[model samples]
Target: MNFAKGLILCGAIVAASANAQLRFEISGVGSTQIPVAVASFADEAIAPAIVSNVIKADLERSGVFKVIDAGRVISETSAVDYNEWKARGARALVVGSVSKLADGRYDVRYKLLDAVNSGELSSMGQSTAARYTRLAAHKIADDIYEKLTGVRGAFATRIAYVNENRANRLYKLEVADADGEGTQVAVTSNEPIISPSWSPDGTKVAYVSFEQKKPIIYVQDLVTGGRRVVVNQKGNNSAPAWSPDGSKLAVALSRDNHTQIYVVNADGSGLRRVSNSAGIDTEPQFSSDGQYIYFTSDRSGGPQIYRMPATGGNATRVTFNGNYNTSPRVSSDGKTLAWVSLRNGDYGLYAMDLATGQELRLADNATEPSFSPNGKYIMYATEAGRRKTLAVVSVDGRVKQRLTTNAGTIREPNWGPFMK
Candidate 1:
């Protein structure tokens, strides 16, 4: 049996080991890349390898500057010979040092230098517990990203997902640091948990749970482990997507005898119908501006994505190429949408421009794709035989990586915003 089919029958299956490692590398294809070289910390540094690689990865992922391979670095400190670096075509240089405190904590200090003029650009430092060394590195990356791109970096965020281990009959809702470390099970249950969407505040996650033997929407608080059912109507109360303000949720409900879009307050009050067609109008997602809600509907024919004003306006069709499109996730800026589009007899992750309606495929055999809080990368579900895993793809559709643990089959990854 197919792995996905077995997953439904067995209600969560152990997946095989993933064949990939999640790492960052940039080939620097474009001519517009700012040439930057990051050198490994001195051998005396405390978190030597971790900090250097994390900074390199963060810079490469930013898509603004090209990270020069360190294979040609002439120095790794503020005393770098600018002439040598300039000879190698490096425009910017980064050097850092890490120190382990007496309490076993770690402090990372780094400086940016303008290679051309050989002048100090900026200097910063961050401290973290020994366990959060990776987070400290991400923080450094966030600082660099903001300084360069002027947009806040999401390197310090987290991702939550549901994992199923068929052999052990185990199901767990897992949360991990955005860089895929510090994983802990948020909830463990025999029933399935699906559709984990983060609240705008990054404090809560709204998902569907089958713990009551029926589908119900649940909002789970991360810090306190407090949870309550948001909506548990008679049928198909699935896909709880929070609006931008965290005040309203656009959900799909079948309590009216057909699946339709419904908007209700976060407290479950002011329940109002938003879609009234004779079709399945589900998977409702609110635009970042909150002026409109985009959803999956089949009123025209097979399922296609549509957008309607948040206050209820005439619906507008957004997708025309695929026979099926679902799981629409709008970016934080509301300019792009990442979704699953079935084309050429295969389901792949795609992004569509809302203004021009131009669509681009991001990944193959990918579904249920969710965008990163910063809208730079997308995490989606991919299956091969009995193995299901989460795959992360660059928003520009260039880089891809797969993540899986020996513990279970991973599915339904939802990226959360950077926690303040």
Candidate 2:
């Protein structure tokens, strides 16, 4: 935490070995719930799990669809029974099939049928390696979601987070699916790791590691396990935020005096301090347009969110309602801003509509809000009973889901971009 303000946020971080799989417990229904029936895919038993089941889970977790039982195995080639599906209380029916090829790839096909209208809404085919069965299902879900709701789905994206196991004295940075599966350890260290920011292209991650007994920023490639130090000045370095183009990074460096925001090239060169504030200025996040950089600063007697030119000039405060607001994050469309605000002694996730200046609180006791690729949901670390878990709330403050794990502490969650 760059100049900690007595707030700690934890997400759905998994541990090593047997504790890798993250579990989710979603609750609350949206105002409008379209009932969708997903049929069992033929030959999908060869997949990691049932491909149709994964599709059902993805749609259900979005809080936009209520899963209805299809009651039998149905493939994309099956004859349409729109009236039958409508009798089953399903507004839409999803049928898919999966076949394993001789070359060790799976061919998955799906069609979204409008039961009420008795017509086909959408159809798609995805071929993937045997290992990416879940990913294939996610893509199908994304297509179905977009066809029905007119908003791009974020189910196919990935999420990265920091896991600190104080009991075993282990620290790890891990990446997983947005729904918390397919775990991959990016980097591990006995020292702490925090503030993971995904590259705009979803190929790399920029984070702060304390392996050298001091904070330093490092940009690590997700595909290859190679990494290079982006910032390691005389003092502490933390809170690395990637630019929209992925060419440069805005981070907090304490080399000058108090922790201040600076821009640096991804290759660890062309470092220049951007914010010239006597008060600590940190947590620099670039806007979606790359025209401005939003950050947190205490220049106004207390920490408040601010925005300045991407190259840094006069900082204008963006947050006015709260006296303490930090961890500023803008949506992918650049129309919404999400940040952590301290209210009633609880740090919570708050979002503001940039066009109308309207604000709404998302989740209480939450911090570190990261907008999904489509900007439809905000993922953040929040308190769940006695343990810390991750929760995803829709930007409209309607749908909510709680993602939990069996053990370990979770922190610093970052949602990845759309790979397609």
TM-score of each: 0.86, 0.95
Runs with alpha carbons beyond 4 Å of true place in candidate 2: 1-18
Local accuracy of candidate 2 as per-residue lDDT tens digits, 218-290: 8878776678889999888989988899899998988986889899998989999889988999989999999
- Model 1 per-residue lDDT tens digits across residues 144-208: 66666677888888888887776766677777766665676666667777888889888888888
User: Best candidate, TM-score-wise?
Assistant: 2
How many clashes does the backbone of model 2 have?
2
Off by over 4 Å in 1: 1-34, 42-49, 60-77, 100-104, 149-151
What are the C-alpha RMSDs, in order, of all predicted structures? 4.8, 3.6
* Residue 222 displacement in candidate 1 (angstroms): 1.1
